[model samples]
Target: MDKAMQKVNERLTPEGKMDVLSKWEVHTLLTASKERFSYEFRACSLAVLNTGSTEDNAKAVLEQYPDFKIEVIQQERGIKLQVSNAPAQAFVDGEMITGIKEHLFSVLRDIVFVGNEIETNPRFDLEKTEDITNAIFHILRNAKALQTEVLPNIAVCWGGHSINRIEYEYTKEVGYQLGLRYLNVCTGCGPGAMKGPMKGANIAHAKQRITDGRYIGITEPGIIAAESPNPIVNELIILPDIEKRLEAFVRMGHGVIVFPGGPGTAEEILYLLGILLHPKNKEVPFPMILTGPKSSEDYFKQIHHFIESTLGFEAQQKYKIIIDDPALVAREMRSMIEDVSDYRRSTSDAYYYNWILHIDKEFQLPFIPSHENMSQLELHKDQETHLLAANLRRAFSGIVAGNVKEEGILSIEENGKFQISGDEEIMTPLDKLLSAFVEQKRMKLPGSEYIPCYEIVKPRNLS
Candidate 1:
């Protein structure tokens, strides 16, 4: 369909979601379309429409469709979205695709809720650590993500969106194995590894005669534009920011299975490790596994090297490296999740959320990936190990933003690449791991040239 033919102007009601959306909740969208909230809502909406976009540049997509607009109109029945200048791909035969429509409402539901209920309400103090977690609980609860009836089955999968066929297929097989064991899948809700596992598990769920398979995709505003919600994401949730998004994954997931990915994936690993390394959470049976095809073995090795060298052996112990065995990976994850179930049951913790685990305020607070913030990150070994992991997670997060997020990319253009300086011991391996990602085309889609968005500077005394 031509660009003009693709321009959709329609009034759409909710499908499989938010059919009874409150006027006070979603109306925040129409009112929020003024400043920061407007940008986030519009950007996320466009990202949902650009579902299959190959170009992972958020700014480029916004520029491509400058006229896109959405409005929330309330009625006695519920809220209906009047969207115009929407991408044609989101619709089929003049009707919006059911999945895309569902995702669109999810964005509307979340963006407005955070802007209106969570952020604006005096009850939620986002600055305080406990309050932040409480806000996340409310957000997830609002999304109907917290189900008390089910046991621990949600496996949060993390991997790159630009993965090769081998790695992608491996994710699918692993997911299929998980599905045969009646496990559900959750991810960043994008493509590549995220889509692979869900696709694999979907077929397995079918074969096993299971109909209620949950494919939960959790994302935030910053990353959504570049990594749009893939079609397989039956349940799409938009957290207000990346920090909450990461916390949501850990809070809700019973286990984590990581596939080969780039900086963003590494950022996720660091975030999870930072939390697991805390003294208060040592006994928590939150299983984590890293697996990939044999060819992608080196990728996992590089990740292991980065973690061990920077955060020490303790961080390395937090996860297992399982190579090329989908069945074993699934078996291991399923078995471990049972232990998590027992731990939760015994502790009187909610089955839907991990309430006992402690996340430091350092990790709970949002980090702006600005040039100054990126340069000033404390990447040395002087601080606590978990603190160091938190800083390292910030570094990788900045690179991810530079690589895809619209504001980060534009900032890179206006100011320049981010400069990262730390001790030589950490700098060498850090630079090497990033270089390997570049060479492997894990930083971006294959064949798209990558310009280093950040420079790793060694301590002046050593280099």
Candidate 2:
């Protein structure tokens, strides 16, 4: 069958900060060497061109546009992106949408910078925890995401793209409230919960005559295909991986409000908990609130139970769960923002970034979702609670990979389901928690049956 064809060529300059690229950076981006770096960049660029597409499956999207290609052209002034067989929605009267064009090139800028400067730069030293944090800071700085003089107002919202109508409306309500308080919104930068907040905040921002409100989106390559940057995102930054993306959220946002979500959201919560549970971070004043509509009360119940059972009361105590009240959620976030402001003043930390939180190396390193890696994860209480949170974070990360990421899906197709073995005390609750997510259509978009991507195995003696 002949594929749908929509071709357009356009030249776009930086809208926000990416106005020019260095000569070497432009050269590296243009040269397609068929290396892993180039391949990854190509994949991510394809995903960016596929913005506004309704299809959620990355494999399906790639298959549809198998011949789609992008190339960077160096000009006397700067760089231009050439494309072929791109999506029609990204064009109007055969011209690329200005925002989409900026986003497309932003992908190029970030992919090239991360590939050449951060990943290959030996100075990054990904093995060391501080080095990794520095790398994250530098990437965000390069993207001009960090404002040295800004206040602590960015609120990171976490939830799933597959959420139902009621839950999505709840997210919008919470976002509207946050906007009324002049708090900017940050999200994984996709649809559903992510988009709802921005949408609501846009209205509130307009109402409050706040023209400079920021809707920042932090995403990674692996998940961007499934969750394209929503149209509302004024600033989009692509982290190298999910781990860095989560780290970026915590480091940048003043407060967090988690809505109903799936394994991905669970992974984010665990990542934050792991960091906050650290002894050095015991006094850190980060405010985390998990809230949803009345219908989602049961969802949080299961999540609360799982956290209590696996990570114990201390982990559970680290976050507050507010249900059925968007006003209260926003009010609490506002109050906490003041508290955050006071704490940062006392500690003399930057308002734009959290400099005092101590993130361990275990949480910074990328967790490859291979079967061996998943099976070898330490999920017992033999270590520190924060460390166990890191391992559990990895477990959910594997589940997220299996469900959506292209490579993880391909791995599962070839080797069957990922095997997750751990102490029964942990595995039992995990199984229950994941099972609830599956039943509630939280794992994937509704109307699609979700096959178990992982097998939960309980240790004999612990059971």
TM-scores vs. true structure, each candidate: 0.97, 0.96
Clashes of each: 0, 0
* Local distance difference test values of all predictions, in order: 0.90, 0.86
Per-residue accuracy of model 1 over 1-463 as CA lDDT, tens digit each: 6653368778898866777655665456557655547778888998998999887888988998999998777778777888998988888888999999899888877886555778678989999999999999998998898998789999999999999999999999999999999999999999999999999999999999999899999999989987899999999999988999999999999999999999999999999999999999999888999999999988998999888899999999999999999999999999999999999999999889999999999999999999999999887888999999999999999999999999999999999999998888778889999999999999998768999899987564444
lDDT of 2 by residue, 15-100 (tens): 55445667876666666323446666667777777776666777777887777777666777666767777777788887877777
The superposed Cα distance between candidate 2 and the true structure at residue 97, in angstroms, equals 1.2
lDDT of model 1 at position 245: 95
The TM-score of predicted model 2 comes to 0.96
lDDT of 1: 0.90
RMSD of each: 1.7, 1.8
